[model samples]
Target: VESILDKENFTLEELLDEEEIIQECKALNKLVLLDAHYVLNSLMFSLRDRAQVEQLLRYIVEEPSEDDDSKRTFKFPFIACEIFTCEIDVILKTLIEDEEFMNLLFSFLEPNRSHSALLAGYFSKTHQEVLRQLVDLIGITSIMEVLVRLVGADDHVYPNFLDVMQWLADSNLLEMIVDKLNPSCPPEVHGNAAETLCAITRNAPSALATKLSSPSFVARIFGHALEDSHSKYGLVHSLSVCISLLDPKRSAIASPLMHYFRNQHMYEPPIPVNPETINAMLPKLGDLLMLLNVSSDEKILPTTYGELRPPLGKHRLKIVEFIAVLLRTGNEAAEKELVGSGTIQRVLDLFFEYPYNNALHHHVESIILSCLESKNDAILDHLLHKCDLIGRFLQTEKQPILSGDNNLPTLPAAGKHAPRAGNIGHITRISNKLVQLGSSNSCIQAYLQ
Candidate 1:
């Protein structure tokens, strides 16, 4: 096996075990991580003899064709990429800390480059602390702009770009992409921006929650979706970032986001829960509800799922989930505006209107459970006086089985996707919670009675 930082003529591939995957004599990083002794000492070992840093860069930059093959070029890119993932602290720090080396590393990403995905893994491996240093070396705006340009410059580069974005996201520097989310920006930029944010949200929601926690940031995210509902991709991903941030259980390390008014439970929201953001989102929800509540002859759904139609079905699902969070989280300005909007009825309407989709039911149930658990007088009043809470539940009760559709609320009914074991069911459980809460509150008690 090759030694770290060894100047004694050695091949980088030797650093990895002889018979593991990806290429027999090559290193697979997952296996490298398991080398406890190597990981513990790899950093110190690299520092003792730093020359290997330059050696790895040569493999990455040259990225030679497979045939000509010098000893290092044979599997050079693979070897360098995998090694960087090992003792990440040592190799990544060495690459990014030195401005000259950093520039060489980035050269692998120059426009029209081939084999970018592997090269991107190299970029993604750089430590975020290096972000500040690199930013100082070359302005962040320029760097991201160039990177985004490189992304769209070639279709081949797109997937590879995501690999680099993972590093940028961890580094907390998505400013350019976030700004590009504005509808005012070229529509072309909007797709990439939305997707980049979507990827981050999907891959690392909690991190994104912390990274984009500003009131203004949250507001802009939803604002763009409304301004440019024209793009299905934009609206879907824009809403995705919002909905992920609202995850009640996410509880991102609240920043100044905590200074705002609290939710019903007084818990910190995943995003800032900006009053402005909530305000922007409601009209869309209001309009969507109006569409659902109406007796329209126009074809609304493609199939039994009852989603709005291409690029739109997914968007509607995200919108419902987003509203569910807002309802559960309880922003005062949001609640006051949303009260008596028939949100519960509208979502429940979606529940029965759609073909069996457990995802839709979970969100619909969230809205119902949120209202049933409400401590706010206005919400209780809305539920009892304004909306037909009891009648809706009755209409919803045992609907699938009684109608003999044989539809089960549960998906796959038997696997890990299955719900927990319980003798009681959805309506029964909600009814019980309603009864428990009504036991304590006069308004709720009156409604229950």
Candidate 2:
């Protein structure tokens, strides 16, 4: 043991020699074959030269494989991880200023690359002060790609990545991400850009809110994306960001969609939401809702299918929740737009389709409750008559009320109100208010009665 220790105890000068250290690193089959700490110390000492640092970073970013002509496969990334684990500040200070080194690190973010995890981990440990400097050199898109890869590549939780995400938000990277979500961009690029925005809004919501204080930029970008049929891949993630940002309790920022819905009449030419876009998105949202309301029986399949499916429950719930937020905002124009767009009917269809989903029931009920509470005669008339929403509710209860009966029939308590009794009571109270408001003429009262 003493002899082995003695052999490993090389002086810093000997280890720092570029050719000698590279040869030693190349000789190792695995990073564990050498003393990682010693290799890291040597690399740090050799990082004074910009060319050497870039060279070392390039080596670290590439993975070891037999097919490569360059036989250098020492797992320098593993050594870099060791350095990051111990002296990230020192190494970042040395490399962060080097545009070439930063670009080399950014280059590893290509989706096909295997070493992204290591680079992500390295950047994850880097101090914000040092990381902020690399923002310009690395560019926002590259930084977002790095973050998207970091979150996607590893199953393990990385709390440090949250700090990096916050820094990005504070540095105003949202607009860049939104800009990248263009129809012309590749699906993967759009997906990454959208995913990055979702992650930032989720992990650093307050920072994102502060950065997106006006909401116009994000709104316009998402609106355009939402209107484009080719952007389906990006739309899901963009919707997620919208959901997070518009959450009144969780998000401090107001959504531009919400604003648009509230004041759409103010625009000369209304936003053109193509029927094609609506048709494409509505079903996706509906399918997500149905998937969320999956029965317990759905979880146990008889066959060992090609692969077990992931529960679409959460995403489904998220879509409904987003709609619920819009309704709860009490924006009359928004509510009217939703009704006109058939979103209200779709939500009702989902509500009736999934009878046993408590979460779905709650969100759908909230939308109803918001509409009733708005007390806008036009809106209420639309809900009660035009959409025949009350008839749908009666159908859901399976109890048809007579047109002129003074007494309402006893609704079945079991399926009718088991998961949503409060919703029933809310409807009853609102129906009475509508009757008093005179919007409930004989035609409307017939459904409520």
Candidate 3:
């Protein structure tokens, strides 16, 4: 076999003429159904006719309408996997156009907990037309399977998978991934999946609110993400994603997200809770306070069978409160390190900056105000300081002020519907702070008063 295929001395045209090439592919395709390893090993041997080789390979795995007995006859999935994997680029590019081929590829690839790299590699190398074909043919169900596979693997393909997931017009795949964080996965997967989900929402938020009402999957994903395991990466991400997904327009999700905020918990080592998640959710601080009430031992809470603690670890919740504490009152270092580490910005971008058109702004403001009322000077101090900083930037900074003309909020003519006074008042007061400290170096004083 090696001697036959190694005869690359022949030109591409010559190889096409060789009857042996066709015979070999037929033989290999027939036997491939019997023993995948044989073909997988032979894959390294350069086939004389690469095109025909690829076509014959696609035949065994991709042919549609195979009877159960025929499926049994072929010992597929594994064989399909071997082919898809052997010349990953070739298989993906060739089969992607054929709906049946694409379905077979996804079915075989979907179950593996670590196909992310392979899928990503295909996306990276394959032509755009082929990629579009793959995604279009992959379908929502298989796409979800791909998400699950990628998340489970937690492979290097995360970014590539992210690129494709972002282009999806449907939210089922996103919901499926986010939902798993709550319970289907352990703490790490919850957090990692959350970060990926948050990124998706960030890139396409308009698409996000469209599906926020149905967040059963999100609840589960974030529920588990709230844990503070040894690795806080995922937990922090889960926290961020949860906040991003909240939309007062989707009152159902808003309430649940608020519940999530109220139910903050921590994970021990192996799954550390990220302090940043707390800071980003700070604008919704009321939810944190509510969670404290929910977790309190004073009232008897409902328990599941053999329930030990509320699913979220007790210490983990304490950690969450600690983060809330930082959001409310941490020093510049805490903000610089945690909140400033892009987490808070992300939250603000989703809830405060964008999507307010649908009532999300009120929920965000309500959360922040509730946190300000915590009576914990630390929590109150940090928030007040941040708001002051934001106001000063908007009021005095020539860039923000000039830019406002193009991006300013347009109010209704007179009183068709007055905007919320609370938000207006908060801005007014913050602006006042900025005004009082016009030229002097008194940011702290402005924040303090």
Give candidate 3's error at residue 60 in angstroms. Answer: 13
The sequence of per-residue lDDT tens digits that candidate 3 reaches over residues 1-449 is 43444564643334333435444444544453434555434533434234544443443433334455543334332233334433343344445444444344333233343444434344233223333333333324444344433332233443344433433324244544544454434555544454445444434333342343234444454455554343445554555555454322222233434544553342111112234433344444333333433234332223221112223333333334334334433234444443344333333332322222223343344334333444344434555564443654354333221121213222222323322222343444434544544345243355544
Candidate 1: the clashing residue pairs are 2-14, 304-355
Q: How many pairs in model 2 have backbone atoms within 3 A of each other, for residues 3 or more apart or on separate chains, i.e. clashes?
A: 3
**Model 1 Cα lDDT, one tens digit per residue, 1-449:** 32333345544455532323224222332245535555344434542245777766766665666675554544655656555545344445566545567556655555566655655555555433344333332323444343333323233444445444443445545665566666666545554554445434434333343456446666667666766554555665566666655552332323212422233245333344546555655556565444334333333343322223222256667667777778766776566656657666566656654435555655666677666666567776776667676676676553433222223222222222322222125456567768877778777788777
Error of 2 at 137 (Å): 15
Write down the lDDT of every candidate, Cα atoms only.
0.52, 0.48, 0.39
Between prediction 2 and prediction 3, which has the larger lDDT?
A: 2
Model 2: runs farther than 4 Å from truth? 1-41, 44-90, 93-172, 176-210, 220-234, 251-317, 399-449
The runs of at least 3 residues in candidate 1 whose Cα sits more than 4 Å from the true structure, single-residue gaps closed, are: 1-173, 179-211, 248-312, 398-425
Best by TM-score: 1
- Determine the backbone clash count of candidate 1: 2
Pairs clashing in candidate 2?
261-334, 288-316, 292-313
Ranking 1 against 3 by lDDT, winner: 1
- The runs of at least 3 residues in candidate 3 whose Cα sits more than 4 Å from the true structure, single-residue gaps closed, are 1-42, 45-82, 85-172, 179-192, 203-213, 227-231, 247-449
TM-score of 2: 0.42
Tens digit per residue, CA lDDT, model 2, 11-35: 3323333344444433332344235
